[model samples]
Target chain A: MSDGYTESTIEVAGLPIQVLRGGEGPSVLVIHHETGNPGWLEFHNALSGSRDTILPTLPGWDGTERGDWMRSVRDIAAVCSLLLDELGVADVTLVGLGFGGYVAAEMATANQSRLSELVLVNAVGLQPEDGEIRDQFLEAHADYVKSCFADPANFTDLYGEEVSTEQLIAWDANREMTARTAWKPFLYSQTLPHLLRNVTVKTKVIRGTQDTVVPAAVAHQYVSLLGDAQLIELVGGHNLESDAPEALAEAIVA
Target chain B: MHLMYFTEQPMSAYDEHAAEEGVTALLFSNSNFDPVAGSQLYNDRLTEYKLAEEVGVDGIMLNEHHNAPFCMQAKCNIWASVLAGATERVKIVLLGNPLPLADNPIRLAEELAMIDMISGGRLVSGFVRGGGTEQLATGVNPAYNRERFEEAHDLIVEAWTRPGPFRWEGRHYQHRVVNPWALPMQQPHPRIWIPGVLSRETVIWAAKHRYPYIALNTTIEATKRIWQTYDDAANEVGYDPGPENRGYLLRVHVADTTEKAMQNASQFMWMQGEFTGLAHPVWSNPAGYASPRNREALVEVMNGRRPPPRAQSFDNQIENMQIIAGTPDECIRKLRTILEETRPGILALWGNDGRVTHEDSMRCIELLGTEVMPALRDIGAELDLDGPFDSEPPVSISYDEAAKARVASAAAASGD
Candidate 1:
């Protein structure tokens, strides 16, 4: 409940989903990445200053009950849409971060009736024509997290010099959920670019200038494919939300 | 005791430097594979198996791994089929097939059945969850590994035992027609064995199902714990388990001299860390592949809170009996200590791998057959240890005297 947010578990289509809500204005739903929610970050705090920032811990991530029947990203996207409908929120500005961006994009394509704007930060749904999406599962956890940051110190600061066993388990669980959904095509949907053409929301595709995870070409692809989307390159790495929180917050609210 | 021989069938002809550079056996490029050398190694290994049979080893144990040079057998069943044709009297024990990797369990069942028929019912079918890297290579979701493994196992068993054309509606598998024409020659299906290392769940599962649980190269302390778990599970399932339900695999290599044996045995360490790098921790134990408790233990090792078992040096391994190598007499003496401690009904002697020469492997197998195995049989008799053959496997449907008579008469009638 700290950081101007109150946390509660809400049932969405029979599954209990944990959500954090704060601030007051136009609704802004913040979706987390594959490592799961780090909880109430600086960007979250900043975003809550004006807009009503709603952060839901996706099922199988920390604090949320696993949706065992949910097998794909589209299923999760459907769950989120249902969550929004259950929350009774409209014209929601959906801000998806990393893997969350993929889910958000799917949500937009499936049902845009509840959305007003879309912010995809370092998303990984579209396959890059050039360069490859860095495989997080293939690399060691620390190295993978370091690769996500422009400065490794940011990761250290966020996770600390020593990660606890509990944290590692959480990360593993999140990765397991990610693997269950996105392992086959490996973080990118082959038809996501084509699908993005149907996402008619005002979209902002943000990529960190030094992102090693999702290539610049992927960002360009998202922008080119979307009916109303622009690419914003921030001076950070793949984890722009953590490394360049202030700048990322500015872009989200812009 | 039922004594068997095994090797990883390493493709050691590849560049050691390239393998070391890759830092993982799974990711090591196959561009370095030498087909000509691979052919030679394969022939040498097959010859070794034949020699093992001629030398009177009861069985030849084989295992499979994918995308790794450490184990050349991509599918152990394929080798089992070849051995079924190539040799007689030796049980082709697959320890075992990666059940979850098979998209169609019926195909696997049929293949195993063919091997059984070819070998005159000498197939000891085993199932394994497989290494986590296998899941990545085959694109099977790690999260569903256990479910897939259990479902596929059930499906395969049903395919073998039941009059098929039935439907399988399991969570991870769906077979509308569960029919396989090639049923195993063994009545009520071939004997199923389970092999694992430090997986309590697997041990318990094996025990509950009354399958022999083979501990693969685990430390004596770990092996004891595994047996304890198995015994407890067996007790819960209303059975008093005996040594017939237990098996052990040891990296035991014997040669003419102790010095030569030691030298060849050090080759067993070839895949440990020096050359074919150990699987990367993340790749080897992928998310959701292991139980939560096991995953925590692995994380502890990865984070340096606990040292990995691989940290043991070759000399330490030898001292600890994890690796046993000597002249046949010397090996026999050391093996007595292991046999007394574990009292397993089945023992698999992992004879050679890595840079161990074909000549040395042949000599090792010859010596094991001529000296070590006979002595082990004597020790087993003295200790009153009986294998699955001597004492009925708890789970298998018994081939009664009448069934045996029927089979004998059928063989007699088919004879020229």
Candidate 2:
């Protein structure tokens, strides 16, 4: 009884990108956090009722092809532009979660014409001074993982009886994806805040107040600095979009 | 050789009730979530396993997959450890350890052997080269997967059987001072169940050693060919392979009436369609066989192209017989037909895939156990069938007193 989405590995300019899509409405191009998995059905199900959400797993994440052309965040931004053009979705809301928020900011700054609105949740595109993005998910500790959820009871149904090797591999894959995208000496770009000046889209920086990865102060700065942006904090952590879909839905709809 | 499909945690009361039926086996594939969260999920799974054991299920199963948020348990070894600590009677089947992908098979061998010992002797071990997407994530060369599997098997078996301190050498694997403790409680090794379509290597190995081969859910035409291949290979080798050597997997659901069953199964069918809808054409195409040997028999499969098989009606009961959905009588008839024709010693059913509710699945299991199994038992008795299978493959690990001590110390230190 849930909304569902389907995806395909279309060779866009000879590179295999896993594109997720569901519903039939004005297309909303979705970008994933650095630690994204192949199951976009959850997000697609959440957003499919109103508009088709096209979630494309970033290159080098989830076994997608990392074509030579994709060198930096700008390249990803360029690819998002091409993807929007290919799907023929115009004046769309560019939704990004975590690292995806960085991509949304990039698109808003460089390719603002295609984006009608931008939504960033627990985003990481710039450095922080007071606190740091905890590497719990990447580190794969049982305790840190428990803290990520709003309801710990959901862990068993979502994770299974005990952490099987399959679960470990699944988590490892997520870490691997993060490693591929953000494993350099400094995870986020120090120069990204400067890039935020050019983005003039109607932006909403939705964040989890307790999210270790992207804290509130950083989000506040992005909201204050952007030409037209607002910040709304919620009750979950980095993966709060899926955890608190009601709040997220309102943010997107607003 | 009992076959079981360990289900996800029962979402409804009906599924909980169904877990109590004449179900001899249960499988629970852990979802991909964090381990701390998994401990909570594990309780739900453990409840099912403990209930199934209490209801006299012959075996319980676990499997592994990575990074799927929908499922949480990713590591079967860790899962096995937890299950070993909790349950006592039901046989534990890992179904596979994906030998080729594991960076350390020695650790896997030591761990599996320990699990086997800890669970008294009820461990049905299965080895596999794993699937494609997994290979991609593990960075394993799909082309050399078979070779890697073979090599790992040799090393694990060597670690199990050969008495202590020996040098192990192989192309894909190399280990020094090869010593593994905690041999399996089952004489020789616990039973080995090989699951897949008819691969030449698997069939030959299973036949040569008389291990059970569980054919995964495949078309009737394909099953027939696979059976014939096993039969032909056994005959050529001048061996009379027993019925236990043959088993087929089927997705079945039987309700009060054929109409009810169909109605319940429709959502499951839609789930399957929605799940696989985005895959490349090859994955969704039911009619086509991936290998060359079975190309000619491809046309016999009902859903070759336009009409997706999972979404289609139950066609020619004999031709495309794997999808068994109907009233109890209808299901019993299909089960009887398969048992008679294939003469398989085992019939493993998975009536829940793609949104199949717990109620429907439990109903199917209950009907099969209450009505269908008794009928099959009568038929088997009439045929003068032998009792349940007892032949087990040889164990690979054996432990001396010192080695046992080492294992005990290791297990204690690791808090296993």
Candidate 3:
């Protein structure tokens, strides 16, 4: 819901991906959660207050039709890399949340040299040794929405008035793609921590203080995995972008 | 019109009412299982198959499911071996072995070969892409379900017909030494029968491969549409597909009276509910199991476009002919209508499920054998519908035939 934010479609690996691009300063690449982008929400508004935001609707969500041939997180990382090269965006801030966070971590693993900074919000790339990732796929949509926020929002509010059939289709497409990519080894890759050993990007692992979808220990896990990573425990839960966007945006730029 | 006796061999001894109390069957909770009873149930199922053979069913179909008491027949091929040993005349139709879930296709080939040998070349090998529920159960990447199914099937067939001691490096599977000591009887391999739901890709794949496409337990209209998809695909390749290439699995519970049959139908309802998500949507539709398009259709079904399977009354299923019930005569009439509609040569009769009593299952089996089956055969003759056995389904490769070619190539290479 912000002005000066423009949207366009970009082709990467033969599939068209819808991307939101705008801002006046440094470039920031945003990969959305399993539920797809929250549109140009308040988080985007604040995060891009003085910087550019390059948010692509991940394949199999919203306006982006998944290239079924590309079904792995590693494939997604490749697409993001192509997205960067296509936009001539190097040394950009990479912010990913939940499923997107997994993709960001993967990208950093492959080539963090392209990234100026890496921010993961309630990231799901690492399975915690002490606890397991909550089974979001098994939860009721209403309950899932509830678990995503500390002060839970009504399902109606999250979905807006009377969810459209198209909206439901988009949500399912996103979930299926998430399942295809994340179901094995579950929400985290078994080899990611070992892969992250080589990642030296200025990485930040941000967790909502009460995030239930991802355990608090996982934030620490992410920090431990990266060579130079910081942990930022923030207010709200899994979906801090929607729960407390202004604060999340501040933390991203901070 | 060939009647194939089928059962999930369900361990349905638990309080199905426990579903309301939060017990799940998909990737089933072991707590609900009574091992003592399971032992008996397993024996009873074996006997049921024996009875099916004695009663003159053309074939017997065993399906596989995991973590679900829904189908205790987890390894259909293992049961196929037992059935092969037990039955004399009947074909051991493994309706299937979930190909995508198997980590070793060569092992599967060996096992099927053993069954084919044990049964004296009566194995009808069926391959499945596996259900979405298997995504979580097998922990196989759901994204690679289709790929794994296709690759695994190819690998198994290659292991059977292709002179192995070779190597296979494919996308989803890699075998350094693609060889197996045990090779299938009946030359190349047994005829392949592929079971599918409403997925168009599966229908097309089955058509392209000339495998008999058995439409699983869906409505008449859905089954017709699925058959149409296969027929269209075949027609595109200038092939006129016959009933022999089409199969249908119908959950049929019959008794002496309609009341007894309706009561028994509750078992299927319990399964339908859990599967359709009336008890829980997640049981059947755990995310990523299906394509994005299929998943959306499931969401719409829950949103009231169609009642969740759990909520459907037995009466509704009967009305839709999704489940064929009632007396032998009534069942005969309903089945005839389905036969006319779908025209599947391979008719898989799902005779038992859920909390349906074993006694009722046996009686139903008896009635199906003595009464229902013979009547159906007459109709089959009248309709001129022939299954795989009636008209031998073609196979592309022959191990002995191919072996001769391999020997020739080896001699030529030696420059002798």
Tell me the docking grade of candidate 1.
Answer: medium
Writing each residue's lDDT as its tens digit, candidate 3 over B142-182 gives: 66778888999989888888886999999878888987889
- The most accurate candidate by lDDT is 1
The ten-residue window of minimal lDDT in model 2 chain A covers: A135-144
Residues A137-239 of candidate 3 have per-residue lDDT tens digits of 6664445655787764533466765566676666666666777677767788888889898888898899999788888888998888788898888888788
The order of the candidates by DockQ, greatest first, is: 1, 3, 2
- Model 3 Cα displacement at B403 (Å)? 26
- Tens digit of lDDT per residue, candidate 1, span B323-407? 9999999999999999999999999999998899988999999999999999999999999789998976544423234434555
Which scores better on DockQ, 1 or 3? 1
A21, model 1: CA deviation in Å? Answer: 1.2
**DockQ of candidate 1 compared with the true complex:** 0.58
Error of 1 at B405 (Å): 28
How many residue pairs clash (N, CA or C atoms closer than 3 angstroms) in each of the candidate models, in the order given? 0, 35, 4
Query: Candidate 2: where is the Cα deviation over 4 Å?
Result: A1-254, B1-5, B8-44, B67-73, B198-201, B235-238, B256-260, B267-319, B358-371, B384-416
Candidate 2's error at B42, in angstroms?
5.1
Among all windows of ten consecutive residues in candidate 1 chain B, which has the lowest summed lDDT?
A: B394-403
TM-scores for chain B, listed for all candidates: 0.92, 0.72, 0.89
Evaluate all candidate structures by whole-model CA lDDT and list the values in order. 0.86, 0.60, 0.79
On residues A1-254, what C-alpha lDDT tens digit does candidate 1 reach at each position? Answer: 77699999899878889899999999999999988899888888889899999999998887467878888898889999999988899999999999999999999998887899999999988888999888877765666777889998889889888877787777777888988888888888887777778888899999999998988898888888999998898999988988899999899898
